[model samples]
Target: MPDAVMPREAAAALKGDAALPQKCLDCGQRIGWVELFFSLFLGLFKLTIGIISNSHALIASSLYSAQDFFSSIIVIISMKYQKRPPTEDYPYGFGKIEYVAAGALCLAVFLGAITLLIAATRVIFAGVTHPAHWVAFWAALVAFGANVMLYRYSECAGHRLGSPAILTTSEHVKGDAVSSILVAVAVLGTKAGIHHLDPLIAILEVAHIIFMLYHMLKQSVGGLMDAALPEEEQEQIRTLVTAVDGVEQITDLKTRAYGQSNEICVEIELDPSLALAATAPIRNAVKDTLLKGLVKPSTVKIYLAPAGEGRALASSRQQAVREALARYYLGHVKRHHLEITPSSVALRLTFYSQVLPGMRKQICAAVGTNIENNIEDGTVSVSEV
Candidate 1:
């Protein structure tokens, strides 16, 4: 897919306390209502015709449609709640409710599939009376066409809005479409005197339902667990942040999926002497770059840290000690003793100095302060030889 670049104006529009755009929310809700209506209608129509025509496949397909009806209800409820503004008690908003709804939908589907499986198995052992009526074939065909339209519409809307609930509902509609077609074929086979074809097709429909349930379950569980974004997307974010002008180093980057969007936390190093005012532009640039380059909706937070000495100097306590000596202009034909520990670094310098005793003590104090600042948790002592 082409990279999704949200416009600067649109990103800015969401900066304040506003929720998502009303237009998008309206569209999602409209789609959910439409799905709910069609599923209910199809479920009733198929169930009624399946019984009249004595077709096990049509009955099983009707159960799938019934599951879709309930799933649509959950999707609608989740879409409503997920749009609510964040509160102090739940700072992240209710976006994860979509995943919760998806999990519930999976459970409904699992139960329906199991029920269909048992009924079909019993029918297979019981003997068929006669071929299914031709009216059931026509009903399945009509359900198939309706679901095809719903699937396309829902899939398009889901991608546009980045709504997980809508996307998962679309998958359900797509499966319904496929199973309806299979039901239609089985009905025709029964008319051709293949009595077992009906129950066999019902069993196949159950298998398909279970397969789809597995995928939806996995996606919902990942969302609930706050899984990280895909590796490629994380790399893309890193590349964008590194290209900003003032970022000296990236110390850490964290990304996690929050509902349909991603949340990113990045820590970057800047010049130690750079003014705080100078970092604003760099921060804005990184945020804009990520919003434009990433495929999904995203929120970014950046932390600024002062750049320290290079890795070689940071690792070697001796280098830190030498820097302290140079900074203090300490004159010495000096021998120094160094001690390093996990908690602190200590350096004792014995040197020749012409300075008075009072000045020498002051120099020692200054050197100790310098070492603490540079080595970050350290002490130093200086004495005349």
Candidate 2:
């Protein structure tokens, strides 16, 4: 939604450390803890200096730090649960929990901004003024420098891991450094008996926080709704899948994020005449390529379409009805048939011709393992002709 998001080319430029896993739970956990510790330290340090100096700007910045501390803790907690394998109750796994945590963090930042704005307004309206406290000034300087270092480190980890949650947290740190400088300048202005500058600085910082909150909320909701991958990412996936040795073309590709991880599903075009023996290795090639290059252990479903017959083969009754039953009991059979009652037209599916006898059982096992994949209620009866 926001034009501020990185473009595809820019995001793609962020290559990983050759040694890093496409996705790593340990990396996610480490980044969460790093941000948590950094926020906690800054919050306590700033609060101490703010109270000693009696500077409203310092106090406001410190409260923001406190909010960050809370948000980071939530992230740390989510990272632990988000790695749980998909269960019967939660079929998609708990990766989306990271997005939920991100949403909460945004909410906290927004509320903190409101509170800061209210306090700044009180100082403005009540003609309350305090001299710039030297102690607060020094504290802000140290906080700013520390934030810079943390932001760089977090950014490196975020890109290497391709974790949106980590990337967002790193961006927060960068923004906080800028806010610290603004607060420091306001403190100096207040000490010069220019108290008006305090409210102005607060207003600017609050405005930024409001926009960031909107962005975070939008992204969080999009992930929950299973939004399509950004157009550029889709193109990259397409290029990668099609370039694989045996893939003819890409029919469709779908991607959605779960917390800090990515999931991709692809439907591929293939030559019908290729020996059934060749299909498995080709499918595996596409899968291995994606797993190694793009997503970390993502679920990839490949739909094999015989060239030219793609459309005619898909919606025909024989393929449709038989596919449903095959998916249920035969483990994803290739040969199936269905007849339209009204027209008494017959449709034939020759998927069996696409696989070798030895491998049919394995392929079937994969297809039939998930009964929920059945698109129709279990009612089809088998008949011998």
Candidate 3:
């Protein structure tokens, strides 16, 4: 029997710390809380300063901050639910909740962008009474600094935890940081006597938000739909599975993304002569290979099929017959060939025994009976060489 040994790294990643460790969950919660606090503080500060100074750009940035605050809450909730183990009612666990949270975040950002766009348009129609107050510029600068810090922290935390929600939130923070810079520039331009620059910058920020919304929405919807992994990754999985020693052919391979990880299902054909006990190690080998390779699926299901099942070709059936004969003959048989037809199979065998008066005929009859009993309808011819 082949050893069903799994690589240490593969074992750890598939069954150990890489699969949502409690420490990582705790870190995700802390990061979410930190983001929520900063988003709330900055949203209120920017909104207040934007209103006091009539800075449209700052108001738009405030709306983005508000969205970030909402997204932070959703992230925390997703992390809480995602920690639950698979149960009878939900066999796949709550990993998909992260995608739902992401979709909601995209919707919230879309609505905020539309609202900011309308408000900026209205402000553009109405003339500016005066230049934006210098205080609003300071607020924008502060928001920029805060968002930059949050982006750095959340990005690092996302990578460490391997949480898609955290990573998406980090991208949002990065966008907010860029928007803040634009807001600051608009405020300075307004103070420098460019009357329309503030509202124009607000419209520009709306455009950027919409752009980000497209990508976030695509990813969230893809996850919800159980989209397949990229073709390159699928091909890589095929290559690894085919490299296993006993795998004859891959009949089926499937993959889909689930939260931060992926799920894979593969069906492979093995030699018909292999005992049921022998297939266990082959399955384990395939699983270990995938986990050790770049695929690293969180869930792997392998189905084994014997050669010559269903639509298997004539050559496969011939090979199965040969294997069976080899087992039955032990070391006595020298050479053998098989011909399979729609209704019957014919096998020719050459043995290492000396010819005697009717020994060849008796040997042929015995082998024919054995082949017919073991395999399908078949005739065997034996000769001494």
Best candidate (score: TM-score): 2
Q: Assess the local accuracy of residue 135 in candidate 2 as a C-alpha lDDT between 0 and 100.
A: 81
- Which window of 10 residues has the lowest lDDT sum in candidate 2? 1-10
> Comparing 1 and 2 by lDDT, which wins?
1
Judge candidate 1 against the unseen true structure and give its global Cα lDDT, from 0 to 1: 0.74
Model with the higher TM-score, candidate 2 or 3? 2
Could you tell me the lDDT of residue 130 within candidate 3? 70
Q: Candidate 3 lDDT, tens digit per residue, 17-83? A: 5554455556777988998999999889988999898888888888778778877887788777866
lDDT of 1 by residue, 1-385 (tens): 0112223122323324355445555677798789898999999899899889988899889877877887788778876776677785797777788778778878877887898799889888887876688998999899999999999998977876776777877888888888889988998898788889999999998888788778878988988898888898888888988998888879888877766667888877767555445656776777777776665667677765556753233356556667777865546434555433334454555655565677667767777777777665434444443
Q: Which candidate would rank higher by TM-score, 1 or 3?
A: 1
Model 2 RMSD in Å is 9.2
Write model 2 residue lDDT over 1-385, tens digit each, in one string: 0001111111222355533443444566677777788898897888677777766677667655665675577668766786576785786678788677767777776787788788778877888556657887788899899989988887877676666777777877887898899888988888787878867777777777777778888998998888877888788788888889878788777788776666677877666556444666787788767655664335555655556753354345344454545443353343444332221222333444445655655544443333224324322233321
TM-score of each: 0.74, 0.75, 0.73
